[model samples]
Target chain A: MVMDLHVSLPRGLTLANPVIAASGTFGFGPEYSRYVDIGSLGAVSVKGVSPEPWLGNPPPRVWETPMGLLNSIGLQNPGMEVFVRDDLPFLREKGATVIVNIIGHTVDEYARVASRMQGEAGVAALEVNISCPNIKEGGMSFGHDPEQAYQVTRAVRQATDLPVMVKLSPNVTSPALIAQAVEQAGADMISAINTVVGLAIDVEHRRPALGGTTGGLSGPAIKPIALRVVYDVAQSVSIPIIGMGGIASAADVLEFLLAGASAVMVGTVTFQHPGRMQQIIAELPQVLSRGGFRGVSGAVGQALPAASRPQTRGGDL
Target chain B: MAGQQFHDGQVDARIVRREEVARDHVELILESPALARAVPGQFAHILTPGMLRRPVSFSRIEPDSGRVGLLFQVVGEGTAWLANCQEGERLDILGPLGHGFAPPDPSRPWCLVGGGVGIPPLYSAAAQWRESAPDVIIGARTREWVLMQKDFEQLGLGVRVTTDDGSWGQAGTVIGPLQEWLEGHADGQVFSCGPTPMLAAVASACRGRAAAQVALEQRMGCGIGACLACVVPARGQTQMEYRRVCTEGPVFLAEELIW
Candidate 1:
């Protein structure tokens, strides 16, 4: 029996499967390739890159919570130039579709980074990161502010020929409005929930656990919130959605797909099992078949109706 | 290149034996043939039921028996659970990961310094550096806290033990003895693993004399480099670079570290 796992967004960016490595959680490829076969996965969403290299946050950058991991890594990368020169060719050689995740402090910075990758031959898509909570400037601000979101999305959309994916944060009150605004600004697709803003404390020392003071919450703790945001934004935007936040198992991926995501990126839990990406991908086929879906694309939004009162379900249609 | 059975992949291991080596600290001997290829300073990551893997250094590895030993202190809930493991209980493990120490140059004198729980990896290295007749130095709060003193002697390395309260071999910090010894072998090389202050002291003593390497410990998430959690500051041209303690090193050249 022939099975099709391919799912794609606009501009013909087709994922060989519905499971791609989440950005930052999977550095371009080398880090994870040491554990599993990078070529076997659908795509690799590399770490976020800026115009210049980012030094990231200080030590004690992470604190393990019950069923979750809080991190304030501040998007550390060797910069766009080094990424293209040192990292890209390696992933391209390994037969992996590389999704370059880019971040910036201003709208111009986003376009500048996008423009830098304009002629890159190996990149499959660009993931515009406007929802990182660890950075002090222009990260979570763009995702929360509708105007900034639209401007950055439109500017980067105009800067490059590759399909654009906007990674959103769950810190905002009305993420669906921001999602609609970006969709209007030509964002080809959306990735919902870039970790909820959170913090932990050391009672004895009276000090914050993370050196950054506050970090993004992920793992099973943020799964429900991620699902809600993805469901809300999925009804508002016509663009394809990539759901994330605390997804570990194949069943979790199927839940996100039914909640209205074309695909799901696995994060936090990947830290638990070194080869979790392959494990999730291997089990996805069985999950789809058991759920009575022919393929991954067909399973998307299976549980959500288009014209009904989704507000009763905690979102609007 | 000890890449014979050394793997970066995860495998299952069983707790073949368990022992309490010091106060609040325990060692678990695991039966995993894959460990035979693991080098001295590399670490093994122990997986729990739901939490992230707890990374512990390879205290001992018997190639012929295909068994490995892990030494760790029960500092948290995750490790507290590990401390109570019954013999024959299976554990999911991923490692022989991370860059270990570079081999000792046979021509130069070798020294191994350890502090508290940091003694394990350096002890593993000292066992291999037997020909150099390396100096083995240990530091702790009291005599009971000092570990593996006899083991170093058994390996034919000269032992120097110290405690903060004058309860052991010396009446000062372990680095004190190492400093006085360093006065003689000005060009010798040293290998060490320990808490931050001990490493900082070693870094200071090896300043212009001995070439040194120190294995670092950090709170880790993935054990692999992906999570970017276990990172330490490294000396760079302009500023400091955050190097992964799990991937770039559990062991590093003292000169490159930002300490």
Candidate 2:
């Protein structure tokens, strides 16, 4: 059976499949190229790049938990100027659909990064990261408050013509309210559920395991929370949703799609099994067919309440 | 199909032998033709039952037999699981990774200083330089913990054993014998691996006397360079910057590290 995996986001952004390499985990692009065929991924969401180089946190940036990973990497990147000069051309040459995840210390920094990517070649979309729990300021802080979230999303939206995807944080009490706020502020799409704020203690050190003391938790442990957030946000907004959090298999992808994510991003698991995304992409059609869906679009929002099911747009097989 | 066999420097190797070298320490010999290229100071990232892969430096790499040996202590749940693994079981390994120690110049004198689990890679180096007969110092907490002394001696090299409680050859740390060795061979090159404090001490000892290279161990997420988790402070052009241990060097010149 022929299965349609095509995904169309707002502002003319299109993906060949529903599987994207999540930011931070996949690096810029070249890091995982040895393991994965870069051109075959649905989209490569490079790590969050800021306006200036970030040194990141001190030692012990990552701590492994049961079926999960806690990291406080602080969104280390070489800034927009270096990214455009070094990383972009490589991705373009590799035929990858690049989604640049942008972060900043302030609204202006986010805008500056977005504006910098305005005319860059092969940059398919901009994933505005207002939900990174690792940073001390302007990351999840903007995500927790609706007004701040709206301001950051609006700034990025006005900075460039590229499709703007606002990543949501699960730390907030009401993620749907923030989702609605960003939607009203003109975000073209939403990437639900960045990592959840969590902490792990090192008994031997008598302190936190991570150098930042606390970290953003991702992997299979947070999948349920991600699904809940995606479901709530999908019910609140009309924009397309890109779901990510502990996505390990095609079955998990279908779960996110059914909960209203038009596509899914895979991280963490790639560290354990670098070739997982390709396997998931190849297995998606069989999984989708067995679930009685002709294509990804049909699976999108199928698990949501009938009254709140998203009006998904795409060609069904 | 050939491409699939060795994707991302990963290989499927079966454990050919497993030996408990000492209390809480296990030595595993893995056979994988794909990993035959591993050298001393390089490491393998082995998948455990846990979330992350464990990075263990190669104690021996026999390219002719397609065997790589790993000597590690049971420090945590990850190593404990590795210690429990039996022979003949297949392991998912990513290896022959990171920069290894530079080959010793036959004309210059060299010494290998290692403490605790760190002796494995040094043993591999000694094996490679068997003809050169490099000086080897082995450090442990007690006599029971001393590892691979005979192995180093079998390579036609003199072995000096040091223990904290004077239960072994020397009364104190490896520093005493290392200093003595340095005094004799003023133009010697020192290669050391051990806990951070031991490495720091070695770096200090070799500061003005001999050049030293150290292999560091850090908590890593991705054994590859992507995660940026296993980083060490190093001297950059203008200032100190964190360099990735996995990509740049698990082995680095002593002077390059900030310490």
Error of 2 at A296 (Å): 0.6
**What is the lDDT of every predicted structure here?**
0.85, 0.90
lDDT (Cα, tens digit) per residue for candidate 1, span B123-221:
778776567678788888888888888888888677889999999878888788888879878688988888887898899889889899999998887
The residue pairs found clashing in candidate 2 are none
Q: Which ranges of candidate 2 are over 4 A from the true structure? A: A311-317, B1-8
Over 4 Å off, model 1: A305-317, B1-8
Shift of residue B163 alpha carbon in model 1, Å: 1.3
- Specify the poorest-scoring 10-residue window by lDDT in model 2 chain A: A308-317
Q: lDDT winner among the candidates?
A: 2
Query: Which candidate leads in TM-score?
Result: 2
Compute each candidate's TM-score over C-alphas: 0.95, 0.97
